[model samples]
Target: MSNTNSLTEHDHPSVLLPLLYESAGHLLSSAGALTGEQLRAASLLPGWTRAHVLVHLARGADSRVRLLTAARGGADLPQYPDESTREEEIRQGALRDADALRMDLETSLSGLLQAIGSHPDEAWDVPVRWLGGGRRPVRGVLWSLLRELEVHHVDLAASYTPADWPAAFTDRELRATVARLREDPAMPPVRISADGGTSDLSTSDRPGPLVRGAAAAILAWLTGRSDGAALTVDPPGALLPRVPAWRR
Candidate 1:
C-alpha cells in the first residue's frame, strides 16, 4: 500500500515515489489476467470500456513523465495538444488486443517509475504546467499519479472495490474531498458523518441534513464511484441532498 502520510500541502516525492510504485504494481497485477473479451467489457465509468480505462491510465503515465522531464530543466512538453487529442488517443488505443494494451501499460508504468525515481532532489519543487493549464510542483504530479492508479484500479471493476482501498488512502481522500466541497459555491449545505459520526464535517457554512456512513462508503459516494445507498440521511429518511458533481 502507498504511504499517504506525506500527502500534505507540499508533498514529498521521496515518500510518494514508493507509494506510486506500490499502487501501479497492484493495478498491473490485478489486471494481468484480463482477456480481450474482458477488456472490452464496460468499466464502472459510464461509456468507458476496461480497455479505455487501461489506455487512459497508460497515457496519463506518459503525460506525467513529460511533466517530470520538464521539471528537471528539460524542454517543456505539453501533456497533450488538447482535450480532443487526449480523448481520441484513448479511443484509438482501446481498440488494441489485450496483450498489446497490457504491454503498453506496463511500458508506460516502467517509464514513469524510472522518471520519478531518477528525478533530482532539488527539482521536486519546480513547477510544471498540467493539462488543465494549472501549474503544480513535480511532487504534486507524483501524488496525482498515485491517486489515478488507486482510484482507477477500482474503476476497472474486475476484482477490486472501494472496500479494498487502503485505510490511509480512504481517510485522507475523504477528508480532502470534504475540504474541497466545502469551498464549492454550488455545493449543497449538508453535514457529512463517517464511521457513525466518529468523523463529521459540514460541506458549507449553512447547516443542512446529515449524511452518515462508513469512511470508505462516504469516499466512494463523494468521488462519484458509487451511489449513496449505503449512507443514511438525517430527518428520518429524508432524501440525500444532491451534491455538486465531483471533479476528477
Candidate 2:
C-alpha cells in the first residue's frame, strides 16, 4: 500500500494502536511456541538465530516505549545501545526455556500496550523523530512501529510467509519500503510487481521502473528474502542489489 492508502490522521491513533498491539502479541505467541533448539535455529538474517530475532523484538519494544515517552515530553531518551551490546543482552535474556521467553515477551509487550493505551487522543499530534530523517506525527510514528513488528514478524520466517502477511500490513510496509529505497542514492533503479500489477521505481526523482507479481513478493525481494527471479524484469540487468539490512 502506498502513502495514499495510509490511514488518515483521524483514524491513525485509534485504529492503528490496537492493530500494533495485536500484531506484537501474535509474534510473541509464535516465538513462545518454539522449542529451545528451534529458537536456536538459524534465521534468514545472516548469523542470527531465532533467539537473536526475539531479543531484537524485545529490545525494539523497549525502544518504542522510550520514543513514545520522549514524544510525550518526558526527558531525552537514551540512544539505542550498540549492536554487540544488544546482541549479548538478547543472548542472555532470550536463551531461557520457552516458557521463560514467553513470560519475558509478555511482560515487555504489556508495558508497551500500557504506555500507548494511557496516552490521550491529543497526544497523536505530537511530533516524533522516526528512525529515518524528519519528524512525523505521533500517529504516523506509531503506525511505523506497527509496520516494523509485522514485517519483522515475517522475517522470523517461523510461522508466516510473505503471502500470509496481513493485507493492511503489506500495503503500508511495501509502500514505505519502496518509497525509502527510491529516495536512497546507494540503491539502483528497480521495478516492483505486486498484486498482478507492476510499479516501476527509479533512484532518481523521476518515475520508477515498471515490473510485474504479488505485492508481498515485491516486499520480500526488496528486503533481501526473495530474489527477483520470481518476477519479470524488463532489461533484466536493470534490477538493483538487495538492501544490506532490514530497517531497525
Candidate 3:
C-alpha cells in the first residue's frame, strides 16, 4: 500500500493539486464546524479522537512537504525522523483546543499545497524516501497526500464519507487498493466485481466468492472503513470473506 504507480497525467501536479485543495477545503470546513465536545469524541480510528485525526492530517501534510523540499534539494529524507516521534507529536497536538487544531490543520495543508504547486514539473519524477523505507517519486507524494486528505477526512467522522469521495479519486483509489491487495497473502481469495462488474480483480486463479458492489462501497469495505454489508456475495446467503486490516 506504500507503493505508487509510475507518473502519468493522472498524477500530474496540475490535476492533483487542485483536487488536493478542494479536499483540504472541505476538511477544513468540517474541522471548523466541530464543537469542542465533538472534537474530543472518539474518531473512526481506534483510540484516536477527532482532534487526533485532525492533528495527524496536519502533521502528515507537513511531513510530505518536507519530503518534497528534500527532493528538490537533491537530498533524500524520510517523512519523519521516526514513528515514535510521529505518534507522540499527534498525541500532543491532539490536546489543543478546537480553534487551534482547526487553524493548524488549515495552515499546514495550505503550506503543503503551496509547496506542491511550486514544485517543478520535472522534479516530480525524482524519487523521495517515505517513512516506511519506501521510495516513491514526488508525484507519488502528491497522490499520497490526496489519499490522506480524502480518506482521513472520513476518519474524522465528519460529514465526509467514502460516498462523498470524487469519482476520479474513488476509481483511482480502488485500483490502487486492488493492486496492493491482489497478491497480499493475508487477503481473502475472492473475485471482486465493482460497478456491477465493469471492473474486476481476483485474488486467486480459482473462483471463490464473487463479491459485487459499487466502487466506493467496495473501496470502503476493502480499506476497513466499513463492513461488507453493502456488498453481495455470489452464492446466496454466503458469508463475506474476512479481510485483514487495511494497509493503506
Candidate 4:
C-alpha cells in the first residue's frame, strides 16, 4: 500500500490506533506461546532476549502514551528515554517467566489503547515533535506509533519478518524514515529505491556524490537494522565521505 494512500484525514485515531493495539496483541500472543526457557533466549538485537524485547515493547507503549499526552498540551513529558535505560529496565524486570512478560505487554497495550480512545477529536490537531527531531501532525504521531508496533513486532523475529509486515505499515515507515534521514545533516547524500521507485536524496547546499540503493534497503540501513541485503551503490567512494557515523 502507498503511504499516502493508506493514511487519510478521515481515519484519524480510529484506523491506526486499533491496528497498533491489534499488532501488539499478536506479538504478545506469540510471546505467550514461547517456553519459559525460550522467553529467555537471545534475540537478534545485540545483548537482548525475548523477555527484554517484550518488556521494551511494553515500556515503549507507555512512552508513546506520554508522547501523545504531550502532543495534546499536557505538561512536558520526559523525552522518550534512551536505549540504555530501556534495556536496563527490561533486563531488571524480565527476570521472571514468559507469563510475566506477556502480562506486562498486555497491560501496557491496554493502557495505551484506553488513553488513545479517550482523546478528543481536536487532540488530533495538536503538533508534536517526533523521534529523530521532526514535527508531525498528531495523526502522524498515531501513524508513527502504529508503525513502531508493527516494525518492532517483526524485530522480535519470533513469528514475523519484513516479508510478513503489513504492506501499509512498511510503506509508511519507509517513507517517514527516509524523509527524516534526508533532513539530518549528519547523514549522507544518497539515492534510494523501493517499491520499484527511486528517490534522490542530496543537499543542494552541500552538493556531493550520490549514494544509490533500494529505498527499502536504504531505509533499513538508515534505521540501523534491516533484514534485506539488496542495496548496491556505484563508485562506492562517492558515498564514503557522506556516510553517517550511525551507518558505519
Q: Which prediction has the highest lDDT against the true structure?
A: 3
Off by over 4 Å in 3: 196-198
Ranking by TM-score: 3, 1, 2, 4
lDDT of 3 by residue, 120-237 (tens): 8778778888787777776777888888888888898887889999888898788778777777888878888888434687777767899898989988988889898988999888
* Superposition error at 100 for model 4 (Å): 0.7
**Stretches of model 2 off by over 4 angstroms after superposition:** 1-7, 79-85, 127-141, 196-209, 235-244
Best first by lDDT, ranked:
3, 1, 2, 4
- Residue-level lDDT tens digits of model 4 in 1-248: 11232336535777666677677677767777888887778765777777777787788778767767887775556435555665677778778777777888889888888878887777665555544444445555566557666656666668776566665565656666656666677765555545454445443345545445555455556565563345655556333334443320
TM-score-wise, the better of 1 and 2 is: 1
Q: How does candidate 4 fare on TM-score?
A: 0.73
Say what the RMSD of model 4 is.
5.1
Higher-TM-score candidate of 3 and 4: 3
Q: Give each model a TM-score.
A: 0.91, 0.81, 0.95, 0.73
Candidate 1 local distance difference test against the native: 0.81
> Considering only N, C-alpha and C atoms within 3 Å, which residue pairs clash in candidate 2?
1-171, 194-214, 194-215, 195-215, 200-208, 200-209, 200-210, 201-208, 201-209, 202-208
Q: Give all candidate RMSDs, comma-separated.
A: 3.3, 3.8, 1.5, 5.1
Flag regions of model 1 displaced more than 4 Å: 1-10, 196-198
